[model samples]
Target: MKKIRWLPSQQDSHNRWVVFFSLLMGVLLDSISWSGDWGVAIPDVTPLILLYWVMAIATNNFLVTAFFFGLLHDVLYHTGMGTYALIYCFLLYPMLHLRLQIRNKTLVQMSLFIGVWMLAHQVLVWLITPANHLAMENIAFWFAIPISILLWSFIFLSLRVLRRNMNVR
Candidate 1:
């Protein structure tokens, strides 16, 4: 039997490929997040259900990641091509700046990040979408924020565990 390599030995190289695939996956998932008609009252849960937590925290260059994924989102959804890119850069700026405050905080920190990320995404979408198309009751969807956060926690924790096992800093 071949010996299995430790996570540290393979993480860096594997991380690069994971980032590439994630960009594609992020766009595809976000498109699904936007599809389908809203019926009388129930809130759409896709965005909350499809949170795209990066697999490794160390790969967190929010601007670069955001720009790439946003571009993919725009291309796939056929929206203002660069709009999401700009919004993502703007949204990620604050997150990156506050990185230290969030670093070691525990699951609560991840939960807070999810709420903030969802809020940032919602605000940007609202700001960019034409006022004529606004849906008044879309506000009910904010309740989905917690769900997205819970989803994010799982991904974030998995990445953390993988990184720790690999001795990646």
Candidate 2:
């Protein structure tokens, strides 16, 4: 008989890669600014949040991770430093606690989470940036939510399948 022992260090190294990829994805998502009207580029479709949520589900401690990513988002988007920080803390914490209740979560779940998450993010932005009245005018920009959800679902599931296939003895 043969036995194999798992190493905590190996898992930690893997987690480091995951964090790096998540951060990169967040930055990439934030960088995509397309013109909407009057040369005003609408900044929507936050893949960072999608990746953050997926990472939270895959790993433990969703709140802490979400908070950190939220801070990163604030820095990148040049919004109030704690706007997304607080939102991520509020939305993802309960999600972590109640994750077990989400049975058979599929792409549909990803789509739904994206829609809800975008709506909540927009609301928080509105609350924090009252001077930016245009924010509300463009709330329909949230229609991008479903596309982000689908993209995230593909990325998340593909990565999961790849990892499972690569598991070595």
TM-score of each: 0.67, 0.69
Best by lDDT: 2
Model 1: per-residue Cα lDDT at residue 63: 63
> What is the Å distance of residue 162 in model 2 from its true position?
5.4
Per-residue lDDT tens digits for candidate 2, residues 1-169, read 6866576467656665665565566567667665654222233434334344444445555555666777877887687887777876766655565555542466677557655665565566667755445855764545445555566566556556644554411
C-alpha lDDT score of every prediction, in listed order: 0.56, 0.57
Clash count (model 1, backbone only): 0
Model 2 Cα shift for residue 37 (angstroms)? 3.7
Compose the digit string of candidate 1's lDDT tens values, residues 8-76. 446566655555554554445455643444321232222322233332353555466677766766675
